[model samples]
Target: MRNPSLAPPINRGLILRDFPKAEDTPTVQDTNENDTNWVALMVRVRDQRDKTAFAALFTHFAPRIKGFLINSGADAPLAEECAQDVMTTLWHKAAQFDPARASVATWIFTIARNRRIDMLRRQRRPEPDDLTWGPAPEPDQADVLALQQETASLSVAMAALPAPQRDLIEKAYFKDLSQSEIAKITGLPLGTIKSRLRLALDRLRHAMK
Candidate 1:
């Protein structure tokens, strides 16, 4: 459904040139920080409202998100505006970023993707007095029941995981923590966290079967 014609030329050099040099950005190797050290910047923004950290995030993600929006049908200017709005939302909602649930890139892109979709929908919305509306369809009871059953099954599977794995899964799915946040909370290496999560999910899939 995306309008690829609106996409701009994706030049990594152009995008990276606008951000701080790689040496200036925090890295896992330079410090004892985990692979998701970039998320620590987000946490700093959340706890201290650190403008420097926010600027770093904006510098890194804003251009990428603009490209994403443009690829999704927005004009280049509109994409730039939406990207700024997305960064503004990140600034205001920093406390809500959860590392256990998603990586920083995934979380930011999800926001961008959803915002772009919403903008598109609003642009296409009918006028209040437009008479083309009809009653909405009723909910499907059978489908609802099936979804409920799946939820129950998933709960049981989650309960069967090791406590640590269960805790991560709960934070990711229920509390909506990002992977970096989970790493911070659990003091686990990012690789270890990912491996454990993979193992846990494998068990969950088998349980579902």
Candidate 2:
């Protein structure tokens, strides 16, 4: 259940009265004093259960989170719901936030991305009644051979990638990590992560073709 006090307001101006616009707020890449301030707010929320601190955090982040989700292909209503859920989780998991490993924006946005993925998975999941409770049919030999060939080709392509690019690709696709998360783990700039991933994927595509 979500806390009523933390619920998103009907009017944006009502909640954002004193805070900066979403665009004006510091981003995950911004390593400024504001990041320290946000970390302090998180500490307040965690230790004091201070609604004022939580409200400040919410005002700064909620809209940005919603916009991120919408940009990622969620509709307005779904983005709103996911933003609310993310804020609520922030309140509950405030103690788990580690300032050393990630910025406040990074941690919060990672939660939003993960929540969006979970929602997508749930939407695509088949209902229990939709399952066919019977033995599966035998595979067509031609289809099996093609699948095996494709698998081998992919393995070869992956192995051929430069070590740096290949590591990022594996962390991204196989580990299901967001680019920001990958940047954190590898201690690389976000742009570097994206660039290497693009080059690696291009090479893999060319190889498979």
**Model 1 regions more than 4 Å off:** 1-35, 123-209
What TM-score does model 2 achieve against the real structure?
A: 0.47
- What does the lDDT read for residue 69 in candidate 2? 80
Off by over 4 Å in 2: 1-31, 123-209
lDDT tens digits by residue: candidate 1, 39-92: 667767877999998998888889988887776668998999999999999888
- Candidate 1 positional error at 175, Å: 30
lDDT of 2 by residue, 13-81 (tens): 112122332234334223344566786788688778999999999999999899888866789999999
* Best-fitting candidate, scored by TM-score: 2
Model 2 pairs in collision: none
Best by lDDT: 2
Q: What is the lDDT of candidate 1?
A: 0.56
RMSD of 1: 20.7
